[model samples]
Target: MSVYNQPRKRVIQLIILGMVSLIVVRLFFLQVVETKYSKLADANAVLKKVIYPSRGIIYDRKGRSILRNEALYDLMVTPASVKKIDTAYLCEILKIDMEEFRKRIANAIKREGRVRQSVFASLLPPETYGKLQESMYLFQPGFELLLRPVRSYPYGAGANFLGYIGEINPDQLKKEAYSAYQQGDYLGLTGLENTYESTLMGQRGIQYLVKDNLNRPQGPLENGEFDTVAIAGKNLRLALDIELQILGEQMMKGKVGSIVAIDPATGGILAMVSGPTFDPNLLSGSYKALNLGRLLVDTTSPMLNRAIQASYAPGSTFKPVTGLIALDEGVITPSFGYPCHGGYVQCGRFIACTHKNPGHAANLRVAMANSCNSYFMHLYRLSVDNNKWGGTTKGQVKWTEYLGNMGFGHRLGIDIPNEKPGIIPDTARMNRRYTGRWNSCSEVYVGMGQGLLDLTPLQLANAMCIIANRGSYYVPHFVESIDNDKSDLLKKYKEKRDVATHISADAFSQVILGMEDVVTSGTARGAQIEGVAVCGKTGTAENYARVNGVMTKQPNHSLFVGFAPKDNPKIAIAVIVENAGFGATYAVPIASILMEKYLTDTISVKRRPILQRMMETVTMSAPMRAKSKVDSLNSVSYTATAGEELLKKILSN
Candidate 1:
């Protein structure tokens, strides 16, 4: 019995010894092996600094800088580290009252706590920064100055195209796509900036620094072993020609409309202007937020990018598509004839023709050249009611296909954002509207480029490119090349896509001849250049809007689409002027000047007067003026562009 008790006592002692050994091992690991917790304990004396990268520069096709960066200073403060300093002197240097300084410090303490840094003053003007820098040493541990980059536009044009950058909102910070970004980061809000943000915003770097007991940064910890080098953003070379852009903007002053010029050979946009534009510099630096707010509420809709966003009836500019569709479907031959008696009188409804002469359509070329409404209406009826298709629905389907091939009823997929897809009447939409009771006669107005056809200026310009290419077109884009062309960023834009099938190249030539006749002796006679053979079509879209709660027809929207040098076709253009009459009046003249400038590098000396008249013209209406006030704000110094006498004439009108 005594021996058994002795063994039990030894076992109990061994158990107690094993517990002591485990506790010793745990203490050793926590104090000697693992260092993370110890580092966390020392974090109170560490400061993490962010090194921001400079955004890329933007250049036009001519290597002129469109967008650039300038250094601005910001004042940062840490509340807990603040000591008894010259508060009154600092406030005087910063142009703030002593009470205001106290309020700011208290607010910063509440927002980020006493241990963190907060922005005391942002984007100080050069004069203020100069004064503050002279006395910065007096503020020591509490205040510091840092450099930040702000955008500056040298060209003073392309506000809508280049876009503006601003601080990221709180909502944007919460998004998963922006998880890498912290508070107070700036990003592009619109235009080319927004479209190429990833490439334009370079990589941000970080530096770890040691801090004193009062939380003042000494120098880099461990000699910047963990620091990353900031990479500058890649530069972008755009397809835009600054001179062309400036000219277009100057031409569009005091008007409410748009002008789009494209290089038909490569699908590159040369110039795009939305009238009522503001200076690009208005959206940079400290005034950005205030100006953007004013613009958001301003009735002129100057912030809107009308070239790619606004949609309107193609009007008579759509007639070529109708003629092409009819010619392709064999419903009409190059010489097919339809007699016109002022208009198409069908199904008991009369649709009047702009050309009121009694003559035969006689041939497709003659019909297109004359813009004969009745002949195209007949072609629409023949195509939609063809016996070969056996029914209106099937034939209408075939017609819609042809429209799609022409790049109508769809977004041109331009690189810019907020592009709208214009409406093309489809079987389903027509069926819903007519309750399955519609016929070709029911939609005959569509055949003449009226009723139910909508297109963006970009789309209208692209359609001309397709015809210029004779059968194929490359997608229109703004940026031609980037710094390192290794990425596939521009691969899709380089491919020439062919959508035209079953239509012969000669078929386009027949239509081209008629379009040439238009500039030579037909309605678009104003579009003729001196040595270049211009081909164009004119369109007057009857606009309707709600006035005093009643839908009323306003003045027509003038429109024109054309290409130059008919044989090689260097440029294709589209112009639209709202509340302006006759495409041949304003749109044709504007487009012709732009074509002449691009092709000849100078306006013909003979056309200088025409150019002067256009620049001095003010076509916006009273209600538009009351809403926008753009003419007073954005118009070229009236005395500079037009003489004081001409300025008075414009103002009086």
Candidate 2:
């Protein structure tokens, strides 16, 4: 057969071509007709997104972060983008009333209309958001689910001190002072948050993006390069020593009062705590709903910064100031003497000094050492009264000017927020109260820290810091350095003047000598150390209780102020145990414990056991049965009307 005319080859080729054609057809059907590239089409239609970077953490002074942040999501909506969503169903899912849903959705529609997302609400429990997510397929273009960071405090701590941050209310937004902030901005409510708002809340950044119907970002509308990077807030380097703060809290446990310890050399606040402290994490941004009133309103007033806010009688701790003033004014010489003969000073009908020591205080030195009411009573009479007791420098007017320099008349301008300027009992106040010329009766008791001399535990401690630093002390502060940069560190407060008491150094030393004697063999024997020279004063001031109008029984406020290594002090402390019977018994020991803790690392084993036992045994001890609560601070029985709400908070805690 001729090759060109071979019908078998021709037939084979035809069959092969036919089969090949069929395979190609099938491939085309599978790739194009059957599959239809559905995955790409779906990808184009449905939107998916995730949260960006997590919020930054907050660090302590030593760079140990105490707070945490994690990613969270919020559901946003535009009313115009609505696709027949059940308004009631949506409102029910979000746990909002119809009115709230209407307001939010209306505002969102007003913001973006149908073309873009309008507004979003947060703090939705996972369940509510999950409900919205299930029906997300039914939602329209302007609906969005976006993620952000929520702050979380590791331990529920620092309620009042590290106050809770919250979303701005309408009232807050209306204020012109806050005009710079948007409605959703976080603000510092109190404590360090309020003080360091600028550094803690960094400058905000912005991002612009295009969204699909579901309000999900399609992509970076202007590319990633155009998105402003968010700068996390610079971490705070608070000067507070966590160990000391916790230890101080423990030491003050069961007591209804406060304690403040400051490094006299640096004026840095080593520890500041109010009794019945609560967890700060309770107020964190991502925190669960809590009973706020139950946390703040308590009979013990745990949230109160008693160290700096609440004022009390300084007791005998204020004796040194008066003694120094008397000496500087030359009211008495080193040889000048006053017989105590039990040291009872009669101020009108009041028998002020219930404490007794035989014989008399010989001079300024002994007067302070003995805490003699008689000596100061005489000195106060000389200082405040020009008409009578004219045995002192110039006149009473000169004395007021001197005390003003001692930080008695005004706030100390401390770095911490909420410090109270303790009442100095100025002539103006006296005039208003008495409506007559100030006399010896009104001014006499302050000399002994008895009456009209309201001071904070912190103020007392600061005053002691001044005495230890010799003449003046920088206003006590917290926050040492940040990012290891000394330059960035807060400047230490310098002494405003040469003296806080404006008394002679010699006279101050003389009074200090008596304080030294106190530790050696005095009311504050419990505060003495084997090697460290402790100088301290104990005061028990009477709080006159009135039934209808007239005063009856006296409830004493126990107080102690002191320093260690008396010649040149290191740490100065003040403690107050409200309603405690004696300052030496309760408050002094606490101060000594804190001072010893600060100065030395390891206390003697014997003393440690004794001190621990003392801490356990003694607290705002009282003879009053109904109010006596040794271990628990919130035991004050709550009754309706006034402070009940506060007591409820403590109980809840």
Candidate 3:
């Protein structure tokens, strides 16, 4: 009886122990190991919301705010949760009709299944949001106001440079580059906004909240354990001086060209301006799409960053480079001179010089100051036809190589996008165009900054910086530094790039002396400024364009390149005004005013009248005006004829 009882007790004990173990394992799986069941259960009651981080603020070099974020509200809709609501009331508040309301709802359903929330209306005005907030409770769980950040420009300038942000397109969503982004995310579309998008667009965060049957958020789910905080974007400090930028824009108001100013010390762009610029604020808020459409069709091409995109003949500005090449090649000394009789007619081709007096070729300094075409023509011939080179092709190749080293015929590696690598006719190009018969004499037009040589305002200005720096240069960039930067954002800009290793510093000084003479007593005498030792070269580029579909010889482009305080130059600048007569007439005054403003922080009282006259002059062509959508762009005055007349009367007095 005792043995039978012991076996029965043991069997019962083993069954009970096995049941306990199974229960323990099941509890552990539900609480720790298996998560799918819990996630499914939580999905109904927990709302997982994304929190977008604020974009980085942009500041000018002086710490003045250029761009910042402003809080705006978006009316979002959850189609699945929608119940019987006041449709007319909602439409009245949003300023839309019932038909528009139905269309938006249909769009939301088509964009995302009924389960997900979609934006119904975005960037609501403060008054609209205020009205909606008062009556939002009636809409229940279907409608909600989501906080969003919209960019605002404090200073209404630099539309082409600051750029604008827009929603990601379907093409972008398909690309691997935007894999991390969702359908409704905004990205930089142009300017600095596009270039620094990664730094400006901060990391998004997630928050999980408990909701009731009505889809109302009750509280944080699981005591906020699954919630993540957003990381704000890094702020950027740009190299632009807002004051100088404004002054440059104002001076370039009546013109259709570009102005680039660089700090020779660090290659930081102090002020870069393309005339006929629109307000940067135009590309912000809910009206961005409409405004963008207007800008895209504007014939003036206000969207074009002419400082780096538009290429033009460097004109006499190329004389300095030719002189540098000749001096570096030992083909000509600073004392080398050539004779000119009204124009150069040695090769049976007449090339006119600016000098009215016919005499011996002036020295390099005098030639540069006077902008003597025959003098540079002779120097180009000597350099390319030198006996040491043996042949014209080889000499032309060597000459072209010098230009290449000086950032011509190639992209200069600027920070922004769409930089043009201006045209420079090399041996290969010349041979292709002329079937290998072209010689130095045939391409002698390049000696005077014409022919196949072209350069953007940025490249032209940078060349002036090279001469100002005496050998080396830093790649021109807008951003000076980033806040809390750890990456190598500014590394490349910090490196010194030497263009011509063989050119002596003395040669640059001699050329600079000639440039100084240009402002003091030569062709660019109008560019003189008090208390500043200005060295400059004036250029009148001959360009042809079609007028009324006929090839017409338009007014020459006015250009000026200079750097002040000759000893240790601080600012180097290039100014180009299209459809303008002479460099000394329009371009010189503009450059002089800008240089004076930068160096002295104000223009002399005596020079104010010249600034006024330059600002009042409008040189845009009739077809250019007819083609432009923005009237103010082609005409300096808001009301073209009236403003012109008023300005004429005021300036004439």
Candidate 4:
């Protein structure tokens, strides 16, 4: 070898050594410093499982649990882990055909890829669960039984407001609010459940399990060192009296209307009943989907919470508000009198009054007691035409302001979903309705609680609360408190709203006296309770329905609004019976019975016959009665014969 050739060889050797060194460093970084590959390898050997926490229970006022949880099982499957197995035997136990099994398998694969788990059969019946548990080894790595909690109603009442839960949908999954939820998670679907979902749905936990050769879980990975513990949901305490709620439902059965009762001091709901309601249990567990479909298609609308959702004309029950507004505007004193000969004929329209006596409209208290249409109409005209406001539009705006303050024309912010803010005619609404050329006489029927005035039974009951409180009220809510909760979920409900503070106490006193007279000697004489000093007003709202694209008059809806023990009032209520003859007949008696039951805790012996008749009364039309099977669906055997027999037994005792 030559010396010059040796130098070139040494230089080439150095270059090759540098390249080898660089390769070694890169390999060390990839294998030791980076964690992405290690995680991927662990994923293959580890099974990730989500642990759902127990949902909260709901309790009524007296610590009785209205809603409870029951343990159910869901059949889950991993398509990738599936091997040849006895598919037919499984189908037999599940009560499904081969076609359905195949379809479910295909759907499971499509929903979540082959490696991930999906719900194959959910909320399994107890018999199927037992059979599956015994033969679970045959399915091996693919099928698993998971524990699930389902809601159950113990009292089988309050279907309209208690609500139900359902599986989260695709739309909800994409939203930021539901970012933590997966495709198969369940959530509150309606009513109170929907409103307090965030507080009721607790934190989810995660666990890792070691996988065997066939991808089956053997045990907890690393002794559960990386597992997270789930937190249970907080319980809700409501102000509902279950017994009163049951009685309200009984009185409303076989009828078409709503009843709402409130505690005047706290604005806590005692009972709310929407007639033709189905059992709440129908919306839980296995039959939820089928029963929900039936309820959706039923013509009677059993699912609607009509106490807050349905709007009706206030009728004469609203006359007290008109009188209060008139007194506040300085348009008339309580002693201001008007003479009416059966009706008001001055506006070129004869608005009839129920009483034809001369002194019926002589004063505010007397007029309210009589529910005199002419007196209220004249007061509305005088208030709107007063020279101080300069014009009818300005006067109408002021009147609407007063109404808004008194919990009208807007939602009262109840602690539930789907509360309807009933319609109230304002200046803008009047302009649109009358094309900008309207006068006080144009909407004078509002004074008598007719025309464009519409309110919910909830609103009527709340108005009674305001009057009973002498112009102050709390926002009506079902939940009084939450168990072990620190959230600001109930901040608004605790605050008092003095809406009618501007109105004089003297004005309220006159209205209260008039309502007292209503129960004693006026339209709602049937609402009187012995030794209770009940103050109430009755209303007969005119009903019109569109049939075959033509307007037809139906029977008037009977309504009653009242508060018991006039001073230091404890209970305030509103009852409406649709398509009934007069307020005195059905609405008055229903309200009176409920008030007596709540205040005295039992019906007197003398009123036992009236309770019996109310329990047996059927106000539903023949076609409606035949078409609806809600009573049967509820599993409550309510027959006229049964009611009579029960009443006879009570009376005999």
Best by TM-score: 4
* Deviation of model 4 at 139, angstroms: 2.0
How far is 37's C-alpha from truth in model 1 (Å)? 5.8
Cα displacement (angstroms), candidate 4, residue 142, comes to 1.2
In candidate 3, position 386 carries an lDDT of: 86
List the global CA lDDT of all models: 0.82, 0.65, 0.84, 0.87
Residues 160-257, candidate 2: write the lDDT tens digits: 45555566666978899778566456666677666666556655565655556554557764575545665565566555555455556656666677
TM-score quality measure for candidate 4:
0.93
Model 3 lDDT per residue over 1-653, tens place? 68879989999999999999999999999988999778756766778777888999989888987788989888989787888988889999999999999999999989865656788998887899999999998776788888888888766666777888888988999999998788677888888888999999999888998888877789998899989998888898988887677767767775799999999899998889998777776677766676668877887878898999999999998898899889988988989888886788877888888786744356888788778899898888889998898898899988999888888889987777788999998988898889978878888889999988889999999999999989878999889899998999789988889887788988888888888988898889988889889999999999987879998987899999999879899899999999887999888998888888778877787898998887778877777767776644323211223223433443343
Each candidate's root-mean-square deviation in Å? 4.5, 16.0, 5.8, 3.6
- Alpha carbon lDDT at 194, candidate 1: 89
TM-score of 1: 0.90
Any idea how many clashes model 2 has? 17
**C-alpha lDDT of candidate 2 relative to the true structure:** 0.65
**Cα error, candidate 1, residue 367 (Å):** 2.2
lDDT of 4 by residue, 1-653 (tens): 89989989999999999899889988888789988777767767888787878888998898988887888889999888989878888889998999999898899989886767899999987788999999998887799998888988877778888889999998989899999899788888888889988888888888999988788889998999999998878899999987777777877889999999999899999999999887788888777788889888887889888999999998998998888889888999989889988999978988888889789888888888888999998888888888899988888888888788888889999888889999888988898999998998889899898888889999999999999998999999999999998878898888988997778999999889999988888899888888999999999999889999999999999999999889999999999999997899999999998899888877888887888898899998989888876766676421224224433444454
How are the candidates ranked when ordered by TM-score, highest leading? 4, 1, 3, 2
Residue 241 in candidate 2, Cα distance off native in Å: 1.3
Model 4: which residue pairs collide? none
lDDT of 1 by residue, 43-101 (tens): 57777677778999999888878888989877888888889878898898788898899
After best superposition, candidate 1 residue 174: deviation in angstroms?
Answer: 2.2
